[model samples]
Each structure stands twice: as structure tokens, then as C-alpha cells.
Target: MFQDLDATLKALLDDAAGPAELQAADVSFDTPDKDYKPAQATVNLFLHEVTENRTLRDEARVMERVGDGYTSRMPPLRVDCTYLTTAWSAQAGALKAAEEHHLLGLALRWLSRFPIVDDRFLRGSLKNPPQLYPLPTVVAQTQEGRSNGEFWSALGIAPRPAFSVTVTLTVEPFDQVEDLPQVESIQITSTSIPDPTLAGRVLDHALTPVPAVVVTVVETGAQTTSARDGTFIVPGLGFGVYTLSVQAPAKPVEQVTVTYAADHQTHTVVLSGP
Candidate 1:
């Protein structure tokens, strides 16, 4: 009979995590890939965040086609939904939650669904682990009770559209980093957004040692330092206030707070040190 989990034992399980949002079910990318080979055209599925008339987020696309007719005519569907987390679940497996949070972002880079749809999450049970095949996926969402006869119709699918089966993931890969070695006892988690302002050479540049710059998420005050490679990953942040700060001796500490619908939480934070 086991009651409380042993700290030593728990850390041993690399692929296991507890109290995570179970956002393990995020998406399955399929759009319009090349022809499906001998069969015909390839099939692609992409996850998209619905906007007024177009996909506002980094709507990805996976493609699978066969000739002009054959092959699997049906294309994989992209899912872009929200996971409403209270304080409880959000507290568990911080690093994992952070990974899942950023992975959910589709606001930047425009992920290529073609190479990742089949690797998405598709499962009949939410309790069990998810598959690694289907690229796009979803999380085991916790929804409040809904009213009867109240269907969740994509209000914008104008032209009087119909409804059908939307292939969802059995589990979403919200955060796989939870199983990493660096984050064992103390959970390390974060959130993300795509910072488009980081495009030009000015905003993003590499620098050497001298108080390595830290990528501080403008909102959560989360911190991740840059490596010798001048790389840092602050993944899975959400919408709200945030700042990225850089520190260098003999030079003024640089900090910038950003507020944009981040396409992806993982952005290359660069600083030109003095």
C-alpha cells in the first residue's frame, strides 16, 4: 500500500509527471502536404487559432494528397483551443506546464503542419498516456458543465456550415520537459508569446560572457539565462504583461516589457552587450 510518493523514487521516472495540466493533448498537424505517393496526394493537418474570418494565431498546415482524386481524401483537422487552469493544477510540474503553454502558441513562425500532423495526439481515453505519432494534438481539457441543447458551434463558420467529427487527441503534449533531468524536485515552469519586434538585427543579436543575459518573460518574471551559444528558451507563457531583461557590467541594465499575442513562447532573446 503506497501513500505519499518518495522523492527519490519519483525523480527516477523520466517519462512520468504528476499534477500537470495534462495539456498533453494539444494538436495534430495536417494540411496540404505533397501527394500521398503511390496512393495519391498526401494529407496534412494544422492547428489554427480562429479569428474573425481568418486564423489569427500561427495557424499551421499539414498536407496529404493523392493524385488529383484518390488517397485519403479527408485532411487532418487543426485544433486551437484554450485550457482554463486554476491555481491548483497550474502549480504542479511548472516546467512541464511551461512547455505545454508555449507549445500551444501558434502566433508566430507559422509551424509546418505537413511534417507533424500524423504525430499528434489521438486517444479514446484521457486517463492513459498519449501517442507520439500524430504531430498536432490537444490537452485533456477540464470544462465546466454546459447547458443542454447548447452546442459549441464555431460561430464564424458562415455560409451555413455543417458539423462532423473533429479528430481530437487522446492526450496533448503540453509539456514534455517536465521529465527533463535539470528540473527534478523544484518544478520550473513558464509561459510564452511570439515577439515579432525581435525580427530586425537590432532587437536580436549575440553577445559574449560578461554577466550572461537572462530572458525574463515580461509577465511572469520567469528567468532563463543564455548559454555560451547565446541561446535561451522561455516557453509556454500566456497573454498578459511581460518583460525581457538583460544585464551587463559597465552598461545600463536593459529591460523591455512586451504585450502581444505571442505566436510562440519560445523566442530568441538577443542582447548586444557593451
Candidate 2:
């Protein structure tokens, strides 16, 4: 990817500084060194640094539907590529300085006009199928609190006029998975649950539990006898409204209404007069 970026920048410079014939080089900043021949003009673009563009971070993963399955992939990573671009002319004296300045000026204007590298100008591996998108180029992006004096000194060359070129590249993550199953069809079946339950206590006028009282559901003909505690529970009744009659010694038939649901239902019956 970096090589492709280098190619793209060289092509742009060549086109802008016509006839000067600029070529991208991997040489040090010092132009007078043996690495540079004092023969013709040269444009050196050194990839000084690279860092991830944290601000452009996106969703960690993305999903795509494919036929009967889905594919998941981590989103592409964005990186900032920094380049130090300097120009040189082989000849000495006024002519050399003039040529170098002219080259640098043209390079600056060309890069400034193209804040984004056009798709057509993208070269080498960038033109490949995998990398379909064009990289964004900027001439002098803000590098907070940083200086290049050490950079020049380390290169063993005196600092000259140079421009910083920063390009943003998107790299797709390699971790991807395909062919996860999807829902085919949904099958739902009807179920009849006998959950209805009737429960209550039989009490006399004295407010005391009356044991052995019989409770009957008139609609369903369901009957139950009260236990020692005067409580009766009729389980597994169907859902519907029902009338219940309580029978106790010397007690008139006390009528009560009950609405049974899919859940338990309760009704209290009181027996009084003889």
C-alpha cells in the first residue's frame, strides 16, 4: 500500500512539473551525498512516518447478507502517511537554485490543488482490484508541536525548503468470516393447556371455617369437598364463566360466580341461614 502511495505521488509530481522529469526516491535528505548524482534534477519523496488516524475510526465490524447466510468483517483501518518532499538540481550556482525552487513550487501547487488524489491518478497496486478507492492527499496537514530540525540534522543535510505531504489510506482488516446460517422458516403449533384451578375457603356466619362443605361448579358439574381447614381446590377446569353452589348442613345453597382462565381462579363461599 505504501509503495502504491509513493507511485501515485511521483506520477502527480511528474505531471505537474513538466519536462523536469521527477522520480520518487528512497534516498536520504542530504542531496550532495553520493546517493544523489550531481547530473540531473531530482525530486526525493521520503516516507518519514505512518500513524493510524484515530478520528476516522469506524464500526469495528460490519455485516452483509449473502444468499442463505451472512458475512461479517471488521471495518477498514484508516492510516495517515507522512512524506517529506524535497527537490534538487545537479548544476551549481544560480541555475541550480532556480531549478530546485521552481520544482518545489510546482510540486506544492499541484499537491495543494489536489487535496484528494483522483481515482484516475492512482497507480501500481492501488489500481488493483482490492484497492478500489482513491487515497486522500493533503499538502501540509497540521502536525501539532513537532519540528523537522532533528530530521534534517539526522539526515546530515542542512534544512532546505520542503513540503509535508500527508495522505490517508484505508486498509481492510484481514479477519473476516462467511457462511453463517439464517432463519429458514418458523413453525408454530397450537397448544391447549389445562391450567384452570378453582380454590376457596367455606366459612359459616360465625366467621369460622366450616369443614366438609361441598362446592359445585354448576356449568361444568365439577364438585369438591372442603378439607379440615374448610378449603377446597378444583383443578383442571376449562376456561369459562361458571356458577358455584355451596351445600352445608342447615345452610341455604349459597351461589357464587367464577371466571376461570388459563390460570388459577379463586372464589370464596359463605354459608349462613338454616
Using lDDT as the measure, the top candidate is: 2
Q: Which stretches of candidate 2 lie over 4 Å from their true place?
A: 16-35, 65-69, 130-133, 181-274
Residue 195 lDDT in model 1?
Answer: 38
lDDT of 2 by residue, 105-198 (tens): 7667667878778777788777775452457777866588988888878877778888888988888766657555675654332233444466
Assess every candidate by TM-score. 0.22, 0.58
CA lDDT of 169 in candidate 2?
87
Q: After superposition, how far is residue 234 of candidate 1 from its true place, in Å?
A: 2.2
Query: What is candidate 2's CA lDDT for residue 241?
Result: 83
Cα lDDT tens digits for candidate 1, 138-187: 23322368421223133221121111111223223233222212212332
Candidate 1 accuracy as lDDT: 0.32
Positional deviation of 108 in candidate 2, in angstroms? 0.7
Pairs in clash, predicted candidate 2: none
